[model samples]
Target: MRLHRSLLTAAAVSGLLLVTACGSADPAGDGTSGGLNPPPLKAPTALGSPEGQVNLIAWAGYVEDGSNDPKVDWVSGFEKQTGCQVNAKTAATSDEMVALMKTGAYDAVSASGDASLRLIASGDAAPVNTALVPHYADVFAGLKNQEWNSVKGVAYGIPHGRGANLLMYDTAKVTPAPDSWSAVFDGASAHSGKVTAYDSPIYIADAALYLSATKPELGIKNPYALDKKQFDASVALLKAQNEHVGEYWSDYLKEISAFKSGDSAIGTSWQVIANLAKAEGAKVEAVLPKEGATGWSDTWMVSAKAKHPTCAYKWLDWIVSPKANAQVAEYFGEAPANARSCAETAAKDHCATFHASDEEYWKKVRFWTTPIEQCLDGRTDVRCVPYASWVQAWNEIKG
Candidate 1:
């Protein structure tokens, strides 16, 4: 059994992550320049320097300072140095992000684990030449070698932010924290009406994770890529979890608001939310089950067809530098992709809180990878399932 959306994430910090203006906000009007297509931006020289004006898409809190006050805005610092203007949009989901990127106007994107591979595969992004980015050498090695964004062994982007999929609960209510997903799937009789999960196509992985734990016979290495038997088992588990969920959320702010307002009590979440709740004096704790957890890592990708390749690359380099990555991590609440960023964080233990620099800890952390037509590990006869299955299953479960 698995709680649906709200209980899964109660998370959007990774939503439309590294959300570069991949598509239009409205999704209605053709974001295209010519009448026929969503405008392919000329890679406007609108921006001037890596430190100056930049157009970026990111999640909430990634760019806020409690004051809509521009002075505190991180991008504002960039704008002051270069004559370039800054245009930023905050997206909450990856699909929304991919659509936005079609415009080709955005300078850079913080692509999530699930979407990064897709962007690279679809030819929407260009390979990152690490030589241009000084801090690239300081990133975690395991991250650099992931299966998703790396194709034929070349990296398509730079590492940015990261987090683990964990169970966040109201410790004030439950006696023993949910050690496994079963608590939520069983609808923990102790906490029924208050359960929540995430609402997104990517969340199918949550079910796959639980199934993998319970049914190892299926040989499912990646949740995003499930065989028919594995897929069926996972869906059955989600269907069972469906009964307990109170909401299927796609917004992080709403999840926090719900927890704060008493609409929710227990659910799955990331380290960021749990810590924030702690800061607010809420009775909450983030639990990493003995069974391990699912997690996400994001990358910085440039548009392959970009009109401003030079400017786009400059921005990517500057942003991934230790200092800039630290600022992004602190503001966003995810682990920094660049290892050196740890020393640059403004908050105490910011790196430690997110477990940014601990290579040993990171070594044990399993990350999400993109699912291709062939089995993830290249199983030939098995006819390994693909990510499309998860997308379909997610729709059915949400429905």
Candidate 2:
């Protein structure tokens, strides 16, 4: 049975200042970069007594206490097992998560790739000694010590889950199944005023990804790593797309409502959003598209200023444990980080549907990474545009 509704949000915050630097080594060497050198901070060597409570800032549906739906509770079990009461604040966007982490109020955050590096660079997030997290050994090797979650080989957090941004279309509204992002870019006029795109600065990367294939000369190796010309071309494409857009959505629920009501015929979406839409009687389907897609690989990070480090560490270990990981992955509609979670899911085929263990399939999907002046794709001749610029361009694209 489907566990519950899939509720997810995009990550992209505007107006936050990013450190400007260049020519840093790309850690993952997968066309993504964590360029800024982080300040010195160490993980606790050993666990102390539970502090009785842990505060967390997380994306919607990541830290459920069953209050949203009586059957969908994971936080309760964690609280009961560790004697650490769970206090969660759901952030609507990654930008809100970064701002919340800065306050030093929350003990941990379920952060997306776009926000992870920023937290590390500012010293707001602390390194995680993998030895303290026994479950870390069971996590997918592909998710460990990667560009977004690590700095100079030191891990800053635990990988939570991942999913791609997909091209979702109304089966009856659009003609001929689209296998490419062009359906939403070049051919968007066919559905004029019915096309919906994700509303965030990160959406710019979607356009850049399309340009990589359509305009080969742009040399867009990584969507997040774009120099002035590449960045401008991407911005131009989105500005044009805006004319046909019915609405730009950050809230997944709004996108579902739009598709169900036939207000939106095509645009970007997630696997969970498409699943929830179909369940609600919307004739919709989501695809990775021939050009591939931009996505998120979220990490559960501890705050550098955590007041309850011991409990915070316990929460991290508990969340990624097989049972809890499976529940969150199923409910959130993403691949579980724990390799063993596949067998633990309520739906026997949940892991296969989400490609939880398919490493090859993940290669086509580019997980979200923060844009920095230092090119993530390792081009030393020019500086790539930073996220701050993308935030400005997004406003222009929408207006």
Give the best candidate by lDDT: 2
- Global local distance difference test of model 2: 0.85
lDDT of each residue in 1-399, candidate 2, tens digit only: 232222223233442446655346574543234466678788889999999999998877788888888899888888888999998998766778888899999999999988888898889999998899999999998888778887667899999999889999999988798899999899989999999998878889999999999999999989999999999999999988999999988778899999999999999998888988999999999988999999889999999999998889998998899999999999888999999999999999988888889888787888888888788777777888988888778778888
* Winning candidate number (TM-score): 2
* Residue 218 CA displacement from its true place in model 1, Å: 1.7
* Residue lDDT tens for model 1, 196-260: 88776556667777767777887766665566787788788777677677887756667777787
How far out, in Å, is residue 346 in model 1? 2.1
The Cα error of candidate 1 at residue 299, in Å, is: 0.9
TM-score of each: 0.80, 0.93
Cand. 2 TM to true fold? 0.93
Off by over 4 Å in 1: 1-55, 61-67, 76-85, 186-190
Residue-pair clash count for candidate 1: 26
